[model samples]
Target: VLRNLAHNQRNHTSLIQAGAVEPLVAIMRNSWDAAPRINAAVAVACLVGHEEGNPRLQLDETLVDEILDVLDAACQGTMRHGSFWTVWKLCQGLASLTVNDKNKELITEKGGVNILNEVLHDSHYNNEAAHRYALSAIWNLAFNAASRLVILKTPGLVDSIRDIVHKSESIRTKEAAKGALWTLGLEQDVKSLSETMAQDAGWY
Candidate 1:
């Protein structure tokens, strides 16, 4: 079922838009077993950030938080890609639900900043598709929530982001970093990030 959904690009997205998302959200909410839930989470992620809206599911306020909880649990596990993908989707959904500042605070409050930092630094997850989605989600949040407070609050965040921006050859990673840096801007934090970027520019 997952293969069919994942492989057929058009049909896969169509189901999500057609109200299958609520069931996926339910799976995440009730399932204690991680793998099935992870699969469901991944499916949920595939729907997130798409340009479709489901008016029926609009009343479910718990949707975003439930998805985020699953993603958070997945992160604590060893399966990096699946969990990371879940987070990427949740971030997209959250972006859809709230404005930039609200989303930023929600991401930060949910410890998304730390999770993104870890994923960015984890060499193993870098090449995975799920990780790419995670990076994009982080990029969106960083750009939306770019401010001095997030930088100051999340220790090692600035440096980790700088390393990815300057050192990685992957254009996706670089672009994600750029979104983050663009958020950081020419503020005093730039001095520190710039130094790290220069030092690590050739490492990756």
Candidate 2:
């Protein structure tokens, strides 16, 4: 019953906005099954939405930790593809909520920054779908001024974004990287790097 409510395509994502995420996450904690857990993560991601600003949905207080835990669990196994997709969705949703100092601080405290950087740097993360979504998440995070500043101050984000941009074949992925480069470079004081991108991509 609960599973179907979550898994059914007919199930409206709008429910989460009505404040349904807490119970669903509660169910996930007891399911002990990967499929249901994955669904829960997806649902929370759905609740988060993909826009650049904060959405109309409201997450439960534990929402962030629950999503992070699910993502953390997903990364410790052979289900990298599935886990990545789930995390990708999760990031898209969370990105919208992380526009403030407190949320950005919470995300870093939860280890999100390091995990995302790892995904961007991983050799196996080159496929178009994976690369596109993962890079998009990275770009979104970089769009947050505080987060972008933190990322630039992280010691390797510039090189990481540069490597991903030049190495990736997916136009979506490259464009995502370009967006991040544009945001961080210009809005965050990396304009020299942005000019470099303009030169390379012939954007004159």
lDDT of each: 0.53, 0.56
Write down the worst ten-residue block by lDDT for model 2: 52-61
TM-score of 1: 0.57
The reply for model 2, stretches above 4 Å from the true place, is: 1-38, 51-61, 78-105, 123-126, 186-204
Instruction: State residue 180's C-alpha deviation in candidate 2, in Å.
Output: 0.9
Clashes of each: 0, 0
Off by over 4 Å in 1: 1-11, 14-19, 25-42, 52-104, 125-131, 143-148, 186-204
Residue pairs with backbone overlap in model 1: none
lDDT of 2 by residue, 134-175 (tens): 556556667566677777776676677776666666667777
Please give the lDDT score for candidate 1: 0.53
